[model samples]
Target chain A: MESKNDELLEISNLETLDNYLSNMDNSKSNSYISKIPEVCKEYPCCLGIDEAGRGPVLGPMVYGISFCPVNEGSLLVELNCEDSKVLNEKKRDDIFVDICKHSNKIGWAVEVISPNKICNSMLGRSKYSLNQVSMDSAIGLIKAAINGGVKIEHIFVDTVGPADKYQAYLKNLFPKYKITVENKADSKYPIVSAASICAKVVRDHALQTWKCKEGHEYTFKEFGSGYPADPVTKKFLADNVDVVFGFPQLVRFSWSTASNILKDEAYHVEWEDIENEAPSPISNSTITSFFKMTNQKSEKPLNTFFSDRYLSRKVDL
Target chain B: MAIHIQSGKNDIQTNPKFSNNIHSMPFKIHADCDAQISKYFLQTPIEKEILSASFRGHPLLGKEIQIPAGYRGVVLHETMKPATEKEDRKFYVIHTFDKFKYWNWEKAPSKNDPLVQAMDWIDIAEALHSPVVEE
Candidate 1:
């Protein structure tokens, strides 16, 4: 019932983004790519990469890539694409909608890295830093674009850490293309601005439509901006501290803001080591008897056999 | 107050319920939290028998344990609360299980675990109580 352009217009709409996100498990990272622009497939195109929500303690971080014909760089400026941080949410949404209208010239993709995935990668036994996660997302997006048949020749990226190191790393990975990693590429380059808008719009919509996997019904307004500095976010973190689970999956548990709150408020959970530690000089019996003296009224002394296995008898279900 | 376990008349015999894919987290949560377990708590087979899953952010290793022959596990549900102090609270046997996976935080579930050691006691108790034959 709808024309191709009309369908493409829905790409920036709230309902469509919500539908796409709701269908997938938000606990894991997900990727979405636009249909390759017909012109982009035939002509040599310049691609740009940027991200949004990187520092947020809540919601997903989005890595976005936008590509257009090499000569159409000015067209992005004409569409009012600019640094997403400077533009308000409404202005970014408008520019994204305008970009969608010219779908024949530009194509874009976004990788939505969920909060749970971020926390898992950072806090897991083998620590994976946030910078590594960002780099992987950027690399993944570029690969997705190239694989989708966008004949990209030049690539621009908004840097995560040291720009020179990131530029060298990307250059090493993608030897064929001209890659530029700059501090404020979103402000300097129109293509990077377009990418920033795409990423920002997707991230904003993700926060708006977020359904807590842990089944806590919370409005987005309740936790403002997802920044550790925001008072609302701090209050939300403080108010929702669970004795055992700490916080819901909506939070990035690896964030010092959330972890600090848990350290102060939540119950202490001790994880035993896989490899046995050397026994204490005081002896196990001495410690057991000491605990028995203090816990005489509340608990029965566990047998030596059961204690060796770290078993405690349950009095109730 | 006393508690009474009620065995209801629903006699549908199903396979032993095993939490094969669930992560047995170390800590317990008191709040009534619900989740789409199948969607979120996915387990990957790390080796031939060892399984791995993520809980919160921590990695969990797990393995299935079968109850010794002739032993069964039951899952009970509380059905009613007593109206008066004189009456007892009631719980019903909702289902039964024979084998369930046990998980350890970042450690493999093995014979050294408390649950596994507890199960070992069943065999020991049986051997100890059995009649001895004099040669």
Candidate 2:
């Protein structure tokens, strides 16, 4: 049966999320977050900025820098510096040496947002809202750089929100430094690319800490293992979640798993080992009317087949 | 040298020396250690060479940075050439420094190459965009 939450979502028009992933160039994200007077491309200081963990249902967000001088470009580039996604373990292995070997400057900031914190949020404030908070941490890193008196030429970034909102968020924090927020700053700028690697590597390690809880630890590849949709991820959740002992502290119980249990009257009856109380004062006729209304919904082709509507749910699985 | 070097302020260059004292620089992480950088004044190079991965003028300039702890990705220095000429890949490096303090790349160490070692430090100097190393 459709829950009230499902009804609210249907009316919200928030379903088809369109990020800046496909249309990249117009993305104005650079390392800096303010307006910069256009200067010669030959200028020495350049900032690259980008972010990770946007749509995942779990895990903290991250952003960082792998920047050097224009002249060091050959050496840094010799590190085969590019977006983090393009390289694999073997490739990142070779490129990382060249990147750091030629390094003149490198700095990063990591905010480890706990899954418990996400689970504790009041209804309607999904992990997306918390990820937005993590983006604020990136602004902290940038502000730290500028406060250290790092003069930057141009800032490149992979944007996450309405460009204007993100810009405003940084304005009070960084009175100086031009800001450009866009998607895929990873592919467009080398510093952002390097930052992606640092951020990715950091978050990937964090995910590993919680990989094995109660025996039967599944070794997950270094990636988005936090989301419930991952096969191994779902299995991890299935094995670790013990409602009898209260939900696993790391799992987001406000999600469908918990919601489904709450709605299943039969589960409550069997789980509590309770017999049904006397019929409600509303009478059998009224209860029948409620069932009639619900039955009508089940008759609809879209809602009837459990498998047909399964993919429509936002859960990664 | 003039290639990749820049003029940073003087106050930012005071190097903190070990007192021959037991407790020295805190193992604690500093965002960018200005004191460590101050010890080694990075005077700009007079002539430019092919870019390595370093930039002298970058605002967060620091020399105290620990080099790559190990190698994950590997590539030739010449590969930094724009991808239009050949296939591009992720940048990585092999560590020459055994005592890197912070950044962790030590996961996978590789055998060394005679050619890379034989290259003149002058070329390596130019590639990283710095002048001659005091050491």
Candidate 3:
């Protein structure tokens, strides 16, 4: 049965969904949000940040922010914005609509980090670790809110990594705002709960409507919530994977699940040393060893022609 | 001596000091080249060495990388002959396949270039217009 949330998302249109994916360059990132709420200048606004879909192997990871006057925590509670994981999709969608209706009182935003973007960022040569990437996204959202003329005072965050470290990092970044980073701050703080709802809802919409190009065969029934642990999703991954080209664009190639799946099914060949000529002590093989040739014969310094810079010979996998 | 020899065939494989690092072609590239390279690698055959892989300038690797034939071109140092004297050339030494292979090129091999028969890097030669290694 199609849930009201899916119906509201209008995800059934494959062209619309594929167009959204096509808007961003492959391996590039983008975001989506409801209109930013106009903050009451007289009241000190409190902002809460939370992320959803961090664990899922498919779909984009979403970061959400919810903000309102510090005194208006009751507004969120009255709207039934509690721990989103416990809330039904209909209930969350209802709460999201209410939040939208009361835009002046409540402001929210969501950043959808595509699987391709995640793969690109994580696997790129510079190697911005996932944690760092998450932090950057959170920080960017906060900065955007403040820059957009929101008077943010106290910040609450739900963290997956070390809370203390995350808090310290945020504090360092925004010295003017009081920051609290804790595991499951979503349950403790109404604003965070609202953010969690926003995140979850957006993620659902994204996943439900996910599409690649026109010709590729795709059906929503095959992919579940995109969690690695889900059998349905795993089955989808296992079934849909093209050994040569890999799973469709939705799958994060950098994820061990996807890569591991490919390795298991595909006929991968790696180059290995057929014969070990020098039984040099394994400990002695450093990058410098290439330069420190024991049997020095020619005076040529091996400068531009070639440099023996690869240290792969040290450890045989 | 302008030409120096640094041989890593034995040391890289056996040295316990570098045991923690799993050295292979670090599959990272610039955003611009990523889609093209990935498309080629994923859709194409593995043994079909022509245009197997490509990369931007890397510290441990080469600058403006193209794989297999280009790798062989760098180490062997004679795989590519420039079509014109005005063409600029660059080179790099990278670790791969149990040893450091040299890679350098002035231009990618043309589709009908006689060298394409012997080397596959020519397939991607047009795609990669920049240096694989930086100074």
TM-score leader: 1
Q: What is the lDDT of residue B102 in candidate 2?
A: 18
Evaluate model 1 with DockQ and give the value: 0.22
- Residue-wise lDDT of candidate 2 within A129-175, one digit each (tens)? 54455566576666655554556655666776676677666655555
- Give the per-residue lDDT digits (tens) of candidate 3, residues A7-40: 3443223343344544543333566444555554
Candidate 2 local lDDT, B4-92, one digit each (tens): 21223332221223211111121132222123232121222222321111111011111122222332112112324444633343323
lDDT score, candidate 1, position A45: 95
Write model 1 residue lDDT over B7-49, tens digit each, in one string.
Answer: 6757635363333433346555444344446545557688978
lDDT of 2 at A160: 67
List TM-score per model, in order: 0.72, 0.42, 0.60
How far residue A92's Cα lies from its native spot in candidate 2, in Å, is 3.3
Better of 1 and 2 by DockQ: 1
Better of 2 and 3 by DockQ: 3
lDDT of 1 at B8: 75
Off by over 4 Å in 3: A1-26, A213-215, A269-317, B1-135
Between candidates 2 and 3, the lDDT winner: 3
Best of the two (1, 3) by TM-score: 1
Model 3 fnat? 0.00
Candidate 2 chain A, run of 10 with poorest lDDT:
A11-20
